[model samples]
Target: MVMTIGLPTQQKTRNNQLYVEHLSDDIQDHVYQAILEGVYKMFQMFGGSLSEVLADPSKKGKLKDFLDWQIPRLRVQHADLLDVFQGVQFLPLDKHAFLRVQCFVNRLEGRFGEIR
Candidate 1:
């Protein structure tokens, strides 16, 4: 009934419980934790392969932007308007812009490891 997503950190924080749960002892690499129960299951249900459209060359532009810094910043910024807005400056994306990012989400399934 819930959904979880990963947003890599530019700087580490001591306060996040998700980071604590996922980090291996060495700390150089860590898995991302999904707050959602069903998200990992749904991703596995998709056959564990890139979609035909995503593998095609024409989707490169969409993939590039999704891999870039802009998209994640926008997601974080969406959470708390005044706090996110305070002294922060970044390019913005409109509501319709997210239609293209699903491919990137699909690619994340085995990336940080599944929930179970």
Candidate 2:
């Protein structure tokens, strides 16, 4: 039996972590494209309307709840991958987006009190 096309080979050892074994340059490119497509799909799935997600009091609070609860859990789940971006870098839009989300979280936390 052979595994191909979006299926990763599984190993019995090492707590069952799968690797993209023997990926050529083209297979690697395919993997990268798949990841980008998935990311955008997720954004669209979670973000119905940009204005609603980024604005509107109720909608904004939901997004803040998601970021607070989920992002830290994701960090725990995928720490190795996230380490690639461990360095601090300056970009206007990135900083703006962070500030917007942070401001929303700050407001929400102040309003609702801490998660504890």
Q: Highest lDDT: which candidate?
A: 2
- Give TM-scores for every candidate, taking all chains together and pairing residue i with residue i: 0.23, 0.27
What local lDDT does model 2 show for residue 89?
64
Error of 1 at 29 (Å): 7.9
Report the Cα lDDT for candidate 2: 0.51
Per-residue lDDT of 58 in model 2: 67
lDDT of 2 by residue, 68-107 (tens): 6544453232333223444356665687898997898888
Misplaced by over 4 Å in model 1 are 1-49, 70-116
Each prediction's RMSD over C-alphas, in Å, is 19.8, 19.8
lDDT of 2 at 78: 31
Q: In angstroms, how far off is 43's CA in candidate 1?
A: 12
Best candidate (score: TM-score): 2
Among residues 3 or more apart in sequence or in different chains, the pairs in candidate 1 whose N, CA or C atoms overlap within 3 Å are none
Backbone clashes (count) for model 1? 0
